[model samples]
Target: MARQIFHRSTSTFPADKVYAVMVDPDQLQARLDELGGPGAALLVYAADDGGVRYRLRHGIDPSRLPPMLQNLAPTELRIERTEALRPVGPGRYAGTVGVEIVGTPASITGTLRLTDTAEGSEFVIDGTVTVKVPLIGGKMEGILVEHVQDLLASETAFTQEWLARTYT
Candidate 1:
């Protein structure tokens, strides 16, 4: 059984501005590159479709990990997914996204809700991850949760910074 996890962060930007920045292909790509290096790719939203796809490939350096895990050589971890955006209320939208971690049989599916507030925007992400590997699946779930939390924090910070630089 897959257990669900939820995480959220709020930004101080109007919905239109945030939405525009998110949907801009060049801007999104540039932000991803700045944050994730050359392996970042962004697929822009089209024709008010409100769906965007992006992938980030990060180099894993086992040397950075504890000695117990040092045997694992450096590898590329690919995070790829597409998300559908739908309006839930005025200045608010909620949607689902699918995430595939490359080279792992585990996949995560989740929903994220964005709300435009007077100060900025608030984003809530919730999801369940399914691990296809046996025996280690439970352990992997804990690892995945930690990884997701770190990723979300980094991405949220990057987005906030990018918006400040681009729109302000």
Candidate 2:
């Protein structure tokens, strides 16, 4: 079974600009590569008038894990079957992401909402990870939640940098 997690962040860019960069295949791929590392690969599984489909794979560095659960770290955090579904909206949009971690039957699903604001955009990302492991699973969940938050913060920073460079 999969759990649901939700997260949200607001950006200093309009909805249109944010959406443009998000749905742009090239931009998405480039950003993923930059964030996920050299081993990361993104595939456009589908793209049409409706929406876009993407598959992403990346290697996770165990060294990145917090000291508490370092012993429980998997050889790598392989995220497979990751998909982003984008739905149209009025001055805002929503997306859902599905991810599977390697060596574990558990999977995670994330929900993201982006809204246009007067000065920028608001982004919300919620993620839930279900693991088969009993005791350690809960702790792992906490770690994952923390990791997701960190990733989002880093991504927001990257977006800011990208926008500054592109606009200026």
Candidate 3:
């Protein structure tokens, strides 16, 4: 079964500013340094007239896994995440993100939208998590969803802080 995940975060920075920081390698590196789990790294980055895209690597700590999952999971799980964003309209951007759990049958894919808000900008992600394991797939997906949500929230908070420090 596939589990749906959705998250929306409002930033006090304008969409253009927010988008700038999101695509900036330095900003993302700093974010990964602080919030990305152990072994996190930026693997690939490319930009052109069309838009920006980047790939990152992060790890899941076995110790943080639920007791029920620890025994079944590897000692460490490496996650490769790729994200792309393109201007959709004035003050708006559309994007997509994909997450792959290396050596596992689980994956997460999502669409992202960023647009101007009265206060600043609203960033939203709508995604699905899937685990191929037959008997425990649903439960595993639930846990992965929780982790993904937490990570997204952390990333959002980091972006806000980075913008404030760099631009304010």
Choose the strongest candidate by lDDT.
3
> Using lDDT as the measure, what is the rank order of every candidate, best first?
3, 2, 1
Q: Name the regions of candidate 1 deviating beyond 4 angstroms.
A: 43-75
RMSD of each candidate relative to the true structure:
3.2, 2.7, 1.2
Model 2 misplaced stretches (Cα beyond 4 Å): 1-4, 66-74
Candidate 3 on 1-168: residue-level lDDT in tens?
Answer: 899999999988889999999999998888888877889899999999788999999977888889756755567878899999999988899999999988888899999999999999999999999999998989999988988889988998888888999798
lDDT of 1 by residue, 121-160 (tens): 8888899977766676666666667767887788778778
Candidate 3 to truth, TM: 0.95
Which one wins by TM-score: 2 or 3?
A: 3
Report the lDDT tens digits of candidate 2 across residue range 10-107: 76778767766666677666778788753677754677766667887766777777865455545666666556656577777777788777676567
Comparing candidate 1 with candidate 2, which one achieves the higher TM-score? 2
Candidate 1 collision pairs: 12-120, 13-120
Q: 138, model 2: CA deviation in Å? A: 0.8
Over 4 Å off, model 3:
none
Query: Alpha-carbon error at 156 in model 1, in Å?
Result: 0.6
Scored by CA lDDT, what does every candidate get? 0.67, 0.69, 0.90
